[model samples]
Target: MKTLVMFGSKSDANIYEPLKSRLLNEGHEVDFRMISVHRSPELLERELAKVDAQVVIAGAGLAAHLPGVIAAKLLIPVIGIPCAAAVGGLDAYFAISQMPFGIPVLATAPDAYGSAVDLLSRWGRLDLQYTFDSFNIVMERHKRGLPHFQMLLTRAQAIVDRTKIEMKISDRPVENALNICLVDINEQDPEAPMPYGPAARGSDEIRIFVPALSEQAYREAYAGVAVIRRVATVPGGIWTGINNVGNAMLAALQLANAQGAHAAFLTNAKKGYIHA
Candidate 1:
C-alpha cells in the first residue's frame, strides 16, 4: 500500500517522523513531505494532482488547514492529526473536525498517529490489525445497564431532539439505521474508562465524545479507539464558544446517507437552523 504523510512545517518532524517510520515498518510505500497549505498553496496543489497514494495522513496545528485542503483535492481518505500548537490544539481540532458537510477530513487527537495507522489497517490497506476484546468487555458492562450509559442515552436523546436526526441507540450495529453512542469525558478522573464498543463493533457507527476541560478526555478516547472510523469530538473548552452538536450530528447523518445526499441534507439542515 502507498501512503503519503504531509505536515505544515519542517519543525513538525517530531510529530510526523514516527508515523512515517511506522508506515515503512508495516511495508507501506511511504512518501513524506513538508507542504504548507498556506505558505505553498500552488506547490501543494501541484503535488496533490500527481500524487498516487491509497491514503494521506496530514498533521498541522493552529487553524490546521492542511488536512482539509488535502481532502478537498484528493478523493482518497485523508486522516488529520491536530498538533498542539495553540489553545491545547482545540483550535486545530475544530478546524479539522468541523469541516464542511460534503468534504470530510477524518480528525484524530493531537499527534494521534496510531489512530491513523489503525484506520489504514481497517481499510485493508495495511497488514497490521487490532482486536477489540477489551473494548467489547467494556461495552458488555454498559449493555447490562450502567449509570453512565443511561446518562449518555439521555444526552443523546437531547441531541436527537435538537438535530432532529433519525437515529437510535443500539448494542449492536443495525443496517440502514444510524447507530450512535455518546460518551461523556467531562469528569475529572483521568483514569476513567472510555468504552468505545460501538465504534469497535462497526465502522459505520459514530462515536461522539464530550471532552473535559483539561482535554485529557480526547487523548484517552483516541488512545482507546485508535482509528478514524466515524468518531467525533464535540465543541468544548473552558468558555465553550460554539455549540457543534448540530455539526457533528449532521456529519454523522451525512455519512449514514447516500453519497449524493449531502447537498439535500445540508440545505435542509440550514433551513432547520442547524450548522452544517
Candidate 2:
C-alpha cells in the first residue's frame, strides 16, 4: 500500500528520512510534501484528497498544525510525529491530537517511527508472521542507528558560521552570557568558601542584554545549585519576541536597545574573556 509522508519543510524531511526508508521496504509507498495548508488551503486539500494511502505520516516541529489539518480533512489513518527538542515538543504533539471534536491524529512519541510501523502492522498492511523478519532487520539497524547507540547528541551545535555574540551587561559576570539559563546552583552553605565579587553574588531579577540576537547562544548558565528557576518568557523571547532560534539572537539585541544597554563586550564561545 502506498503511504505518504508529508512535511512542512526540508528540515522536517531530515527529521524522519530514515523512517521513511524503513516503511518503503515494507512494500508501502512513502510520499513527502512541503505544502502549507494554512498558506494554500485549497491546493493542500486538493492534493491530500487524492491520496488513498493506508497510512499517512505527517511531521512538523514548533507550530505543528500541519498533521492535524491533514487528519481532519480525511478519514484515512494518519500517523503523526512530534519533533522533540531541548525544551519539549509539547506544542508539536498537541497540534496533532488537539482536534476540536471528531477529528483525530494518532501519534507515537518524539522519534517514534517504530510506533508508526507497529500501528501499520496491526492494521494488517503487511503479513505479520513472515514479514516481522524484514521489520526485525530495521530494528537491528536502529539499535545501532548512530555510532554511539547509548548517547544521543541533541546538543544543538553552535550555529555553524555564526558571527560573534556581542551583548551588554551591567556587571562583568554577565558579560560572558548571551542566551543562558541558571540550570543549577550549589546548595549554599553558610561556611562554604565564597568567591569575592559583587556585594550580593546571587540576586533576584537578573537582567541580560545583547547587542543583537546573533550573540545569544544557548547553554546552561548556573551549576551545582538548588531551587533552580526559569524566568517566564517566550521560546526565543530572550533574543526576539518571535519564534525559534533562527532570529532569536538578533532579537536579543533589540531587547538590549530597549533597555538602553551598551555593547561593551564580545565572545566567540572559545575562551570566556573580554576584548576591547
Candidate 3:
C-alpha cells in the first residue's frame, strides 16, 4: 500500500520523516510533501489530486487545519498528527479532533506513528506493530498512601536475580548484556547501602530515584547523593540516577530496552516517598 505524508511547514519534517521511514520499513511506498492549507491551497489541491496512495498522514501546527482540509477533499483514510509547535500542541489537537459532522479526520497523539500504522493494518494492507525488548513489570507500592516497602524490595530483588541468572545461562557477553533500572517511588534512607536492594549495585542495574518532582525535594531527600540532572553517560558500567521517576518509567525503560534488556519492573502507586 502507498501512504502520503503532508505537512504545512518544513519544520514538520522531523515528524514526517520518522513516520515515512516507519511506513517504508513496513513495505509501503511513501511520498512526502511540504505544503500549506492557507498559503498554497491551489498547489496543495493539484498535488493531492496527482498522488496515488491508499492512506494520507497529514500534520499541522498552530491552528492545525491541514488534516481536516485534506480529509474534506479526499476519500482515503486521513490520519491527523498534531504538531507540538504551539501551546504544547493542545490547540492543534482540538482543531484536528473537533471536526464538523460530515468530515472525519482521525486524530491521535502528536508522535503517534504506530497508531497511524495500525490504521493501515486494520484496512488489511500492512502488518506493522512496533515492540521493544524491554518487558514492563508494574509493582504497586501503594494505592492511596499505604507503604509496601518490603513488597517493593522483594519484587525488585526477584526480578533482578532472575534476569541475572537468565543472562548468565544465556552466556551473553558483558557488552551485549541486558540491564535493569530501579524506578523506586519512595524508598527513603539515603544511608542505606543500595536503595532498591544490594542487587541494584550489580553491573547490569540502574537505580532510578524518582522521589521528588522538584529540585528542592530532591535536595531535601537526597542531600549528599549525586542526583543526575537530566542525562549522564556512565563510563564505568554504573547505573545513573534520574529524578523524574514518577511516570517516567517509560523513558527509563526505553534506555534499558534499547540495550536489549528483557524486562522493566515499575511500581504503580502514588504514595509519598520514603524519608528519614
Clashes of each: 0, 13, 2
- TM-score, prediction 2: 0.44
In terms of lDDT, the poorest run of 10 residues in model 2 is: 131-140
lDDT of 1 by residue, 1-276 (tens): 688999998777878888888888877899988988998999998999998776788999987999889866655557788887775666676777666644556667666676766555444521212211111111233443645454444434554665454444445444322333333333344334444432453243234333222233344545323222223332211111022333434434433333343446445554544432
Off by over 4 Å in 2: 125-276
State the lDDT at 113 in candidate 1: 71
Candidate 1 residue pairs that clash: none
Please report, in order, the local distance difference test score of every candidate based on alpha carbons.
0.54, 0.41, 0.48
* Root-mean-square deviation per candidate: 9.1, 22.9, 14.9
Encode model 3's per-residue lDDT on 193-256: one tens digit a residue.
3323212222332222222223344445343232221111121212222232212232233233
Residue 23 CA displacement from its true place in model 1, Å: 0.7
Q: How accurate locally is residue 197 in candidate 1, as Cα lDDT from 0 to 100? A: 32
**Candidate with the larger TM-score of 1 and 2:** 1
Pick the winner on lDDT between candidates 1 and 2.
Answer: 1
The candidate with the higher TM-score, 1 or 3, is: 1
